[model samples]
Structure formats: C-alpha cells, structure tokens
Target: MTREYKRNGNVNLFACFQPLAGWRHMELTLSRTKIDFAKQMKNLVDIYFRSADVILWIVDNLNIHNPAAMG
Candidate 1:
C-alpha cells in the first residue's frame, strides 16, 4: 500500500510491502517541502522492491502524483 501526507505544509510519501510466504515486511517514508520525484522512486525501491529475488508487487503508486491535499 501507498499513502501521502501533508504536515506543516510539507509533503510526505510512504509505501509498504509485505512478502506473502514470509514475515518480512518493508516500509519507506519520505518528506519534502515540495514534490520530489527521486524520493518517490527511492521509496519504491527501499520499501516495495528491496529484495532482488522478489519479482512482483500487488500495490499501486497512483496517488504519488497527486497533490498533497486532494480529494
């Protein structure tokens, strides 16, 4: 799962992933005063796609591109 937060006018991005066959889970969060494309990609790597042996992820990164406080 992926989520975004806006606190004190700063944009924050977070991603979480879990392995189906194992108890291993990963989570990443990045906070920026503005949009950060590199941080977003890094979150994907550090959180969801950290393992080289893993091949697929079931979650989506849809809301990453949206504004911080959108409906």
Candidate 2:
C-alpha cells in the first residue's frame, strides 16, 4: 500500500480598524513575521492614513507585534 499527502499553505490576516471613520483594512500574508508586521504598519501610515493628523494603533500582544519590529 502507498500513501501520499499534500500540504496547502496557510495565511495570516493582519487588519486595522478606525472606529471614528468606520474604516477598516486587511492584509493577508503566507507567514506571520516581525517584518510582515512592520510592513503592515508602514502601509497603514504611508497609504491608508497619510492624510490623518493622528494615527493610533491597538494591537494584540503577539511577539511579532513588538515595537522593535517597526525598526
């Protein structure tokens, strides 16, 4: 008897929400890494909220969400 297995990759969903503006954004990636968190923050600041005077972030306590990741 022969057995074979196949694997399908998974994804991580990174999201942001602005309750005042009722705006939300989501990013999907194959992996969850510090670099990916930084990129998500970059996109939120550079593309999504560039016009805003102040941008506040609330994130989970995941290791990848460390402030050092932004550097």
Candidate 1 lDDT by residue in tens digits, 6-71: 666544444444556564533344454224544544556776577766545453455444445222
> Candidate 1 at 36: error in angstroms?
5.6
Tens-digit per-residue lDDT, 1-71, candidate 2: 99988878789999889887898888799999999999999888899889979887888889988868988
On TM-score, the candidate that comes out on top is 2
Residue ranges of candidate 2 with Cα displaced over 4 Å? 1-9
Q: What is the C-alpha lDDT of each candidate?
A: 0.49, 0.88
- Residue 12: error of model 1 in Å? 2.3
Error of 1 at 46 (Å): 8.4
**TM of each candidate vs. truth:** 0.28, 0.79
